[model samples]
Target: MPRPICSQCQFLIQQCLCDHLSVVKSDIELVIMQHPSEVGHAKNSVRLLPHLLDKVRIVVGETEQDFAQLKAELEAESRPIYLLYPSEQSVEASQVKHSQQGILIVLDGTWRKALKLLKFNPWLLSFQSLHFSPQAPSRYRIRKASRIDSLSSLEAAAFGLQALQPQMDIKPILSAFDAMIEQQLVHMPEHVQARY
Candidate 1:
């Protein structure tokens, strides 16, 4: 079945409310592995993070060949890689896996999809996973979560980059993300926005 047009904007779901679109400027590189289903999700902010910072890259799709190619490029660089996740098997965000350049791999999708991406891409498991304890609520209203400290893709990049480079002021980026989410929520119907 064709997806319903967004009631408020009359645009296709992919173009309606794009919360995922963000700008990023950071010293650390961010590689987002996004799920196909999350491409249009209003709460997915991976696309937007690169605008806020300068050091961001995004790759969509989940395939062994793609992961292998990414791994080859990353391995050639003299940097440490980290998988940004909140699991018992993860690493702390406070410490850098390597003193050289750091490549942060983030899975931008639902929890289940994220797990699938991680599991399917065994090369990602070789990197130390970075997990954090957030002091704020998530701004992603369209997506439901089992955790209160959940954050949007942009938020994760902002915080992760900040942790890596303490000299940068990442608050403004996060604020912009929040403002964007608020604007999107205001345009959405009360019932849909209420879920946030």
Candidate 2:
């Protein structure tokens, strides 16, 4: 039988994270493009982003139709759209001034899947791209990353939001992220858990 899920947080009852969450209103809107494969993933941080922020829209898929809808939304809004993708052309997140107003699109998926999403959506190439030099190691302990600089979707969003809006408090999001990591660690074999 499936485990009982928490209606509020949507996590299994034993792994519910409602108490750890803190909701905050954001000046910048977040448009998360999630790969279908990430849906219902136990450790998917994208699931927590909408819960933490007041303005978040999740679009799932890489089809032309999906891109069309995203494009329409972008056209409807006057805000400049920025893609949070790391590339040679991407500017440091900190460089994005607070004066800038617009949407931030985050691609949520494995590196390969993220690349596929970009390739499938040619229009996304027009958006400004941003990246961050992580000040600390990623808190995503459950998943092994090919590169040390890699961060989970939530971490990227938190860092990006802080960079764009220096005054915005992101402690709650980070606190909840840490709580999720700690909960995951408890489920691992004691021998496999990292020692601090």
Candidate 3:
């Protein structure tokens, strides 16, 4: 039989980590373009964004048509929007400055898939890009990522948003990520756990 799931965190009922969550209550707007393959995947990190940023929006699709509405909505907003992606053209997240809060767009998927989203949605390139100089390595050890330095969407959101809004508290987001990893770790075999 399938274990009952928590409607909020989507973890098994017994494994629900919602108790570890605390509301950040920030006005920071976040739009996450999630690859369809990642939508319901258990390892998806962007799922944790709502617990941190109450106003986060997650759109599930990969092509331009999938994001046309989002693109139009973004165009109507006069506030600055920054894409949290790493590239030679991207500046450190801390360098972005504006008089008012801005929106953050993040791609949620593996490195290759994320690049594919970028390719399929060229409009995403118009936004200013920002990257992080992370203080630590990725905490998402349960899943394999293409690059050793790749961070989960939740981690990138927390760090990237922190750079833009220096006063926002990100510990709750990070703690939830750790707790989820620990939950998944308990289910893995000793051999699988050793690889991470």
Candidate 4:
């Protein structure tokens, strides 16, 4: 084996491409919950995704129990809840409009980690699953996925919010994220050259 190379962008950097970030407008409240390992990880994008959006909140897990409480608190806001996980059995977010009284929850992690979250947290499963079909390959260069349709948290947020609020111009936010990624990538090669 070639030391378990990153499947996405194929660069290591702790296998993350999270520096690019954006926030989108949505009438429904959006919450992104990430696993514990992701907090200190250089590639972690979950934290950045929420900051880009107007009403997005992100919470990282220090313990599963705390995250559970947080989820309950978020869900208690008296709105329809949906989780973004693409599955044939799951209800797609595009198929339904949340209107004024809904909350959409997104989880960020590796595929295995996401599956673990779904397995350990039954309350999370209680929400209707929000499935999305993206038109582009994930911009994340660090970790690869089997599907080109998969997108980063920020990218997904843009598409989802665009779907929800067609009037909002989220282009600037997306452009900013793209610039950040390019800047970071440019600096990375120089650092490598210096070491050689």
lDDT of each: 0.72, 0.85, 0.87, 0.65
Q: Rank the candidates by TM-score, best first.
A: 3, 2, 1, 4
TM-score of each: 0.80, 0.92, 0.94, 0.75
Please say which candidate is ahead in TM-score: 1 or 2: 2
- Give the alpha carbon lDDT tens digit for every residue of 1-196 in model 4: 4434344433344533444444456576677777777776755655555456668777776346868778669667677777878776686556776556566677777766777877777677777777767766767664456666767766776666665556768775666556545545665777653542
Clash numbers, per candidate: 21, 0, 0, 8
Q: How do the residues 31-105 of candidate 1 rate in per-residue lDDT, one tens digit apiece?
A: 888877888775566655655667777888877776777778977877777889888888668766455667888
Give the per-residue lDDT of model 2 (tens digit) for 20-78: 98798888898889999998787798888877999888999977677787788786877
Question: Regarding lDDT, does 3 or 4 come out ahead?
Answer: 3
lDDT of 2: 0.85
Question: By lDDT, is 1 or 3 better?
Answer: 3
Q: Which prediction has the highest TM-score against the true structure?
A: 3
By summed lDDT, the worst window of 10 consecutive residues in model 1 runs over: 15-24
lDDT of 3 by residue, 1-196 (tens): 8879999877788779889988786656889999999988978778777776777999999999999999999989898999999999999988777887679999988898999999999998999999988888788888877777888888888888889888888988888889989988888889988997
Ranking by lDDT: 3, 2, 1, 4
Where does candidate 2 stray beyond 4 Å? Answer: 98-100, 189-196
- Spell out the clash pairs found in candidate 3: none
lDDT score for residue 148 of model 4: 64
